[model samples]
Target: MKQAIAQYNEAERLARQEKFREARPLLEAAAKSGYGRAWYALGNWSIHGIGCRKNYRQAFECLRKAVRYGAGREALFDLAICYETGKGTSKNVRQAARCYIESMQAGDPEAISEVARIHYWGIGVKPDHSKARRFYLRAARRGDLESAYLLAEMYLTGEGGTTNRRSAIDWLKRAVDSDDAKLAWDAKERLKQISAVTM
Candidate 1:
């Protein structure tokens, strides 16, 4: 285990230096030693064409092994995205939801919004606006500014419950500080529109 971890750490250093070709063999060696993180790195790198040709199929296989070996929350999140978008695997909302929820429980903050998105849009299941709203609110409360924006949209549209303009405004205000520039701009625009309506 220690040797595997050492190899993985060295591979990570090589990757940081853009020596992806050299890192590949080390990652493979670590993965062969049953290191989950090495499998995860290989899977992620494969998809991005870091050291080899971009191969979603290969990435998917590695991700599955990574999850099986408890690679960490990142593997679950990436697997969920693959399942949700049919990128490397068949589109399976149920599987995506399971992965998202598991990732969220494993401390992946972004997974919360993804779970809400599936419920909000009814990707592969029935839309549950109430559930979506609840999940969005949970994420927002956790300091996810993008989730605050989504929650505001739901409030304004009355998707889950009663339409509350004030609540919408409140949520939008929270979202205005988002690090996502586009979302921050949109939130400001929404606030302006709301203000214009009252004036």
Candidate 2:
């Protein structure tokens, strides 16, 4: 276990220094040694082509191992993504929703937001705007910028509750405070549209 931790730690350092090629083998070694986080890192790297060429199949395999090894809630979220997108696997929205729900129950904020999306769109589940709104609220309050933006939209359109412009404006402001330039810009534009309509 100590050897695995050491290898994993060294791999992380190498990755941070942009020495991804050098890190890959070390991560793999740790992963083979039963280090769950090492599997998680390898899964992400395979998906993004960080240290190796993009290989969705490898990513799917590694993520499954990560989940089985208790990599954490994030592993479940990524696995859910794989199921939804069919990245290196069969497309299964029902399974995707199930995994997302499990991760949400495990306290993954991203999973909460995704589950909200499933409910909002009736993706492999019944259309339940109220449940979506509640889930989005939970995610937004947990500091997910995208969730904040979507929740604001829900408030504006009365998707699951009464249309409350004030609440929309508030949530939009929160999204505008995010570091994500696209989301911040959209929130700002939404605020302007509201102002224009009101005036």
- Candidates in order, TM-scores: namely 0.92, 0.88
C-alpha RMSD for every candidate: 1.6, 2.0
Best by TM-score: 1
Which parts of model 1 are misplaced by more than 4 Å? none
The per-candidate count of clashes, in order, stands at 0, 0
Model 2 lDDT-worst window of ten? 67-76
Q: Highest lDDT: which candidate? A: 2
Off by over 4 Å in 2: 196-199
Kindly give the stretch of ten consecutive residues in candidate 1 with the minimal lDDT sum: 117-126
Q: What tens-digit string does per-residue lDDT give for candidate 2 at 1-199?
A: 8999999999999999999999999999999999999999999999999978999999999988988877868788888898999997999999889889988887886788899999999887898999999999999899988898999999999999989888889999999998999999999999999999999
TM-score of 1: 0.92
User: Once all C-alphas are superposed, what RMSD does model 2 give against the true structure?
Assistant: 2.0
Which pairs of residues collide in candidate 1? none
